[model samples]
Target chain A: MTEIDWKLSQDIQLLRLVTVGSVDDGKSTLIGRLLVDTKGAFEDQLLSVRRKRGPAKESEIDLAMLTDGLAAEREQGITIDVAYRYFATPKRKFIMADCPGHEQYTRNMVTGASTANAAIILVDARNGVMPQTKRHSHILSLLQIPHLIVAINKMDLVDYSEEVFKGIRDELGAFCAKQGVHDLITIPISALKGDMVTVRGDNMNWYDGPTLLEVLESLEVTDHIDEKPFRFPVQLVNRPQTPDLPDYRGYMGQIVSGTIRPGEEVIALPSMQRSTVREIVTYDGNLEEAFAPQSITLTLNDEIDISRGDMIVKPDQMPKKEREFSANVCWIGDEPLSVRKKYWIKQTSNLGKVMVSGIEFKTDIHTLDRVSTSELAMNEIGRVSFKLQKPMFFDSYAENRATGSFILIDTFSYNTVGAGMIV
Target chain B: MSKRKLTQLQALEAESIHIIREVVGTFRNPVMLYSIGKDSSVMLHLARKAFYPAPLPFPLLHVDTGYKFPEMYEFRDWFAKEIGAELIVHRNEKAIAQGMNPQEYGVARCCGALKTQALLDALEEGGYDAAFGGARRDEERSRAKERVFSIRDEFGQWDPKNQRPELWNIYNGQIHEGESVRVFPLSNWTEMDIWLYIRQENIPIVPLYYAKERWVIERGSMLIPFYEGMEDQLREGEKPTKVMCRFRTLGCIPCTGAVRSSATTLDEIVAEAAAARRSERETRLIDHGSNTMEDKKKEGYF
Candidate 1:
């Protein structure tokens, strides 16, 4: 078989979204508004759902039921996990992950927002910006979500005052700027009364920003950073020395960064095997080139012993494959992550059994303080050091997130114990 | 300067690959949960491509929700042969004989008892550390909130409130003794995208999804196929509808509903599916309860 390359596209086309803020910040309500206002929900489906829905306190439509579709979820009257919503505006489609505000489900928010591009941090106009607002915004920035929208909800509760909206928006603006947020858009709306949802509101004539749905539609979502270097994480080796194509020996992987063209000079990681790209094959058809996040199988002109767990990149520029590194981690398990424990580390396709060699420090997410610790307990976000058995090809998490991040798997019963972003 | 654009399939493929790598690296013996639904069919296709030329190192696990359509079994048997992957089927014959159905114990209880509970038992019995599923985030609220590497306790219960932090694209599959991870490779693929993919790839699916002539009894706005013994339980008051019906989704013979349609080809199905803004889960009355999936997940449901 000829070497085939699967290039999904040159640009990342999907948008990962999330709604943040503290309890009763109307995170759920805002999501409901976005989905409903966007006309993303079918009329028949909506009607049926409404009819079957349990009676709310005042016979009002339980908008939260739109996202909190689970039984235990509606019973609690609070979002407990990440409820993902798929909607589309005329501009682009989006996957909006609705995260809970309770401190207990902070980890869920982190998970949901990690892959998000834009976060709609709901701020109650009555309460202004609270600690949870700061905490969530910081987490979004840390996760490298490109855009932030501080939604001042419950405008009606505050009598739709331009002063209330301005105050909340300005406070958020200052804080986010200090936290390094560049694209913070402040919007005013009422989730209960459906003001400025699908339609702009006459009540808030002073506020002239795009509607929440419009923001989602018009958000600038081109890939962050430069696609200067081509980096592919080797997933599998395709060697079909069969009757069809005996000489076929190819390395398959998804390009984590940059672009790769056929006949381009490339180097395989660790071994640093230099070769020219022989071919790029894809399912739709063959392409002359490919880019980050696209899955492809590539053939080299030379017969190099390339295998899965190895990274392929341009010979001139390659990633730093290191044995030891520090990372900010969100502890997931009930038991604390002790230094003595051996955890399974997966970076791209490479596998390395690792141990927490040292406890560098932990981040008090709310305060941004680094605390020295040898262990991280459940629901705690911290920093730690890991010693690996084998060197892993990685970039700084901030530089190339897809290649630089990894998860620590508990070897024993096999549950994802922790997720780490390489520093 | 500009945010990268992510395609529907591209995002799904990346997420799936990430999950696959996590399973291979973390678990001792991982298996793919195959229900032979369009989702599972798409999942298996993804798994094959994920570790291509390696003959997919993991086996396939099918928890027999005994009420599955016959065509599903036909596809399952054929797919196993075509792909040459190991397949394991888990059936709770006791529940079948006792007739522990959705009508009796309620949809949640029935699914929880037969499908969810059966899955947990089978995993423990097989000593499989992880079971890769085709759950999409858009399927349900509980599932949307799930991590790619979802963890289950010794009893195999899912706690959405206290899930691990999943950062970057990295998925941590870690657990204590007896605990396992329910890995979802298609968490990002939407229903429309899956249909688009199936049409693009020409992935053969069960005929149930297409418009065809079949004997069906209408039960609660759903056309439950006339399976043996199931027909007798058909509500005496209602008459069966024999329209050229196609299923928007395939669930157990009981709860899954069929929409009246004459679209027989994949293109026609795509057109029909595109028009559908409602989720397939909505078609299944058994899961309509608010937080039902979450509750069942808490009770160790897949």
Candidate 2:
């Protein structure tokens, strides 16, 4: 066995990805194969999986048992919620969100796909492209996930024929082309037989592309987060007033987009107060600069009355501050979303009462067609207009995910009933 | 690597700090459930950093089962004093008065009456709208399905089947008067991540985690550390033996089992964890049965 290079592994970047497909498309099994083949699962965990096996073929280990962690999932033989799994290779560390494939659990899929940098849409080779396949692909496109891998699983059932894989690949390619997917790749694999998933099987000697793990390892690590304009949502106001530094006040928050430097002029939205960055303070000490996603406390040169729900941004790159906007919303609550019903709209750090002004149209995920609708029910995605009681600073969801997205909470129940991405 | 770029540990820290700050910004009255374990130590550290120029905006609550390791209580007091945090210590005095013991009543009922009941009573008495816990999804099977912002009904019961969909980093801290939200900032962290973060940050933890010579008795396949009150519960001919042992998880002295190892430092602990055959929760006595954690969580077990 080769010696494990712990230092190099520690330096590798972490990738967040999600797997989505229709039920019984071998999504969980593919993840299990990856984990088991990579030795991510410990001996005791494998033993537990083996112990729980229910009289399968003597030689076959039920791979899906690895991801179906919940008791209800095991009893019903279907995944109900997103299960997060971790694994690391020599090239990169990965956090995999295994989303449920059932139609009613679209909200769960949306939840899983929200943070994912890439998505793996699995398809059974024998079944080719199903309606659920189109649905997942469309959702991935809607989420603006950077990369997509269409794995034609269960290739052994088709005798490892290249023609069968090509048929499914072409169908998906054509569909993704129309959906505006640029970074799309497809591979043939039998998740159960471990073909083209981790190790290249002998049966697929005709195929020459990289395996599933190779694709994940070599994918581009784009810094798209830092390319956008500076946007920092104030979460807290810090006042230590210590003996050494009496009267020190700073705004604490995580920079959601672009870079911020000391002495840069910024405007706090809603209040529209102007200030200059005095310092960026961290636990290690003060830094000259900060970038997207780094948590830091910013001390301004001016004593502005900025509080939470305020967005500090570069003067020239100001986001839209408005009370009315249209957005694509996914209804997550059991109750249907009615027009004019009051709900709490939480956008970034800002919270305000909002009501649905109009329901434009809902997308039929399977057919990729827009159908007019007056209301959005559970697990439905639609474009709607909202009128907020107060103005909010935001960019389009395509420009910056952190500032563009919001969730609606039921006024009375206080449950998060809907998720929206600003158009 | 770029000098400005953050390592995975640093990234995780930033995310957790953002979450802690969000909880403070969103909820009117929130509290941190500090268990004096390694996860709680990390969580407390993040909370401190989340509001660095100022002290923590909220208080820390420790639900004492009256059966925890004495070292845990000591560390809890010392850490609270060091951070200058408002620590609220509560226990189910009624259960203690009723003489409910894990040794006699079994782990499930004892935990329900002591730990779970104590937490609920404290939440109610304090009227806390949001409570932060250090639960991680990698710890147990059912926990893998838990949302970062988990909602509880008026009875403080979690309905797993009807949980609201959590998308992106936007957590829903919205709740009615009697309802509450359990916020877990460490939801995505694993055991390895916890140890790595603790080592990187130099966070203080209970000494029980490091191997030490202690009196213990072999029970079934586990080595239970001998506490002062265990004499009456010991089986016939079960004599105490001195063993070099360390606890994988800290809980009630009677329920938590120690593993035999000489991992005296965080580095050794991380190496041991990487090469270990079993998960850390395998030795936990409360999660022995199938779906036990799920059942406990539905009834308000953090």
Candidate 3:
């Protein structure tokens, strides 16, 4: 809290992770234990949790009460929405998404996993891998989460047996492998008894792997934005026209991918107008160069009629400009998504009217099988094709998440109805 | 320092700036809620940075409850003029005429009329499609699940149970007429982050946050500042005492409690907050009304 050196703190990597599992798989308990063990919970919060004891024994604390903040959630003894928790260790800072386990809240899990770099899927040792586990894993795979940790929880109930851990690990590994998830790790833990969560537990001597926290801290933090092709979706045009600098037309936006340097030639998409980067301006000062995720304004050499919803990118590495494309859609609205229905599609800074042209199939998360379907209901995932009123710049989701994803908004209600990942 | 690697504070600032720009780009008429607090100061700074070179794309709306600390009003007016931001101040004139005060009518009803109702009236009169707030997730439990772009119904009610799923950096600012979205650019920022950013950016904040010797009366566990002409509200044996104190949050003078401290600088405040054992909202009297924060948010409170 004492003002630390800002430059040195940049090395402290940030890991966005999600905790998922079936109902009562100890997901909330694990998160609570992590926070409590790390001194993330303040003294007053701990006291309040102690005061509001559910029906537990007098000496025992309900760890699940920490994440269940809503009154309705506490009354029902279940997580109803995705609750984000922040905590920091010496090695790294973490923003954890504690997602709901109910089958109906699959959309909530998708929301949490979409931004996560890794996922910790909790599996009860007694139940092994249930149908919900497979369902959650499939969604994570589709979302392209980089890493996954399968924590075989409740080892205390299973006598810390190596055989049970191996059996569950092998089964879960096979399932994940079939789904093309290669970066997977499995550990045995007892969240209730504080085993292998923060510290190395002696109860799990049979397992010689890093603890959950250690694995999370040591995982590679991928910076895909720095490596991918440059993609800048212009959000606004700043024309100050001041006496100090007349005719100043700067395009303002956050660089979604790659870097921009002075004198680099770029092309404005949808218009295909070419220009050179004249300057990179920030509130602090002008920068020599700027990279992905940095919100800066760029002064182009050309005086093209560029406005909002325009994209500036490397000419040779331009995203495909098309009017029709296939994408994997996650239906999130109360109404079903039908073919030929018009809806507004917001991709990056571009907004366009789109209609579903075809529904190829829907994936059965539990079975990992494709079923031929004509319509997608609420919380359903399907591979569909859409026809846009105007050409949109894009990339495949597997290549770049920033430019590959979009949302479908209801034309009448203006509610976000679907999330689409371009295929 | 490597230009490729941004510090955590820098990363948070970039994300917030992105959100602010998105609101300006998508919404027809957007306004920022300026409460003249540290969070709002950080938010206003980010808005300026987000649309630099050009003036701010939206006006700033401050809901004056008619009982805020005098320093807060002074800072609000001075800062708005300095930044040249179009500022709009709204108050429930009818409620004031009806003599609605927290001490007379209790905290909840007075807040409902002066704060919540005043805001609803302002939004309607301005026809603002998007209003940005500076609420953070780490401050309260219910806010931990709030989306970056939260949608409100025509009546300005927030449906916490069925909020839209916010994914990645993409925010959904789509809304129909009479319906508005409450955007929280600082949703991911914590209290520590706010102070650190304020110090790092050298942003000007109200002087009330710093410690000063002020007359206060101890009510239960709170140190309520003694205001002139409010002598009848005191208990039988209680008396006002001058103490070195500072406000953790700026609100109505009667509701916002001051913590006894001598942390006069931002660095000291950051260190004190880090070592403190209680959350900032714990001292707020408005939060004590039957889980009032969530209930008020449901009733269109910011």
Candidate 4:
């Protein structure tokens, strides 16, 4: 317990990953194995797992039990919701979301993948490229995850044959290619036997690719969000109005996209009142330039009308300011979508009443088909048109994930019922 | 322009600061749940940074169990004054008058009355619509599935099955009149991140986190701190002895346990923490087995 190098561990970068596959495809087991080998799983936790279900051998304990945390999930032996797990090595730190693989939990998987930089799609080697595998890949592609790792799990069931692994890999590889997945890595792994996960065991000597952990650690997490157009969604306007600083009116929020500096010409949305950035302020000090994800305050040269739930952006590259738009939505509420119902659309710093104008088509994820459907039921993905009460500043989700994505809140329940991405 | 990528610690810090500001911007009345632990210390530091040059918009609420370590009380008072923050301390006097002790009523009943019930009563009295806690998702199994802005019902109960979908960084903070939101700014932070951040920011925490020679008694696998005048609580054939130990987590006195260690400095402690194999909660008496935390959370335990 005393061999840890603090200096080396502290210098690691952060990576966010989501694991997706079919039910009983060993998604939970792969994650559990990674956590255990990295020393993320404590001895007492492993002991408790063993105590719950006595293991025939020390290595055969049910690793999935470590993450299927809910009472119902434990009773049913299935992951009902997404569980976020953290593990770190000297090279990097990871914030991985263990997503449910059941087809009914597709909405949950989408929720988990919304913020993921990369995704690990688990493919059962015994059953190569199942319908669920294709469905998961389609979702990941639609979400625009930068990197993907297709771990061919249960290699031992196929006798760790290189031909079996290659055949499955090529089948899934071609499928991902059609989906325009640029960065994909395929590895043969036995999640149950702890082979080709964190370590390169002799059983996988035929496989020369990096282990699953290595791909996760070595993958570049460059999203280039700052390179996109500047889009700042003002969360709050700071007017502390102290005695010393009587007239300090600064707009405070996290920069969702692009970089901004003092003396930059910008305009607040809806009002369209133009002004110049006087100062970019933060707790540290005034910055020459501030980029995406950095929460800071800004003081403009002109005292225009601006408040919460408003967007600030450059004058040249304005987002689409319209009340009507088309989007792809994943409906998750128990109650299906009703055109008559009025829902609150919460986009980047903007909230307004929205109504379903029309339903274009619902996706058949298994075959990647768009079938015309009027009703958007639970766990269904569909293209829909919405008419908002007021104009909202946004970009295509493909262009700016921070500004293009939104959620639908049920008016009465106040629960987030649907996730939407602008077309 | 080519931008510099933030290290893991910096990224986590920014995310937490953003969350802290969301509470101030969204809720009318909010209070920070200060437990005086390492995580709480990190949270307090972030709150100050979130609204720098301006004092914290919300006050800190500390629910005292009346059985916390003496060092925790002193640190709590001193740290609050140091930050120039308004600290509200509340204790369940009725539960104390009824002679509610862990030894007498067991860990479950005592924690329910002292910790869970006291927290609910304090929030009600404060009328706080949003309460910021320092719970992390990586600490337990059930917590891993919890959202950043977890909504609690009128009675402060958490509905695990029907949690709202927290997408990206945008949080839906809308709630009913009686409902409240329990926000965890450090939901993504792990134990390692806490120590790394403490070292980076040079935040001050309780001295009990460092190794020290103190009177202790061996209780099962945990080392229970044996203070003077508590001899009656000792079991048969048990005697207090001086030992070098430090607490991995702080909680109520009778239930919390200390670990044997000699890592006094922050750097040494970080190394020891990285090397430790057992979970930190294993030392606490309240966390007996799985599902205990989930059940207690349903009844409003911080």
TM-score of chain A of each: 0.90, 0.95, 0.95, 0.94
Q: Residue B245 error for model 1, in Å? A: 1.5
Clashes of 1: 29
DockQ numbers for every candidate?
0.34, 0.56, 0.55, 0.68
| C-alpha lDDT values of all predictions | 0.76, 0.86, 0.87, 0.87
Cα lDDT tens digits, model 1, B1-302, are 13354556666776676567557756899989988889998998877776655567888989997888888888889989998889999987788788788877888777877888789889999998898888887776667677777888788888765576676666555467787888888877878778878887789888888998777786656666666666567676865556788888888887787777898999888777666656677677766664366677788777
Clashing pairs in 2: none
Highest-TM-score candidate: 4
In order of listing, the candidates' clash counts read 29, 0, 0, 0
Which sequence of candidate numbers ranks them by DockQ, best first? 4, 2, 3, 1
DockQ class, candidate 2: medium
By lDDT, the best candidate is 4
Error of 1 at A9 (Å): 16
lDDT of 2 by residue, A53-124 (tens): 755553467778777877788899998888888877777778899989898887888889989988999999
**Global fold similarity of model 1 (TM-score):** 0.86
Residue runs of model 3 more than 4 Å from their true location after superposition? A1-11, A54-59, A241-246
Q: Model 2, which residues run further than 4 Å from truth?
A: A1-9, A54-60, A240-246, A337-342
Model 4 lDDT per residue over A95-204, tens place: 99999888777777887888899999998888888877887788788778888889999999988999999998888888788767755799999888889998888897
The iRMS of the candidates, in order, is: 6.4, 2.0, 2.6, 1.6
Candidate 1 segments whose C-alpha is farther than 4 A from its true place = A1-12, A42-59, A69-72, A224-226, A237-250, A281-287, A301-308, A321-346, A351-392, A406-423, B1-6, B82-86, B97-114, B227-231, B288-291
Over B44-140, each residue of candidate 3 has an lDDT whose tens digit, in order, gives 9999999887788889999998999989999999999999999999999999999999878999999999999999999999998899999998777
Collision pairs in model 4: none
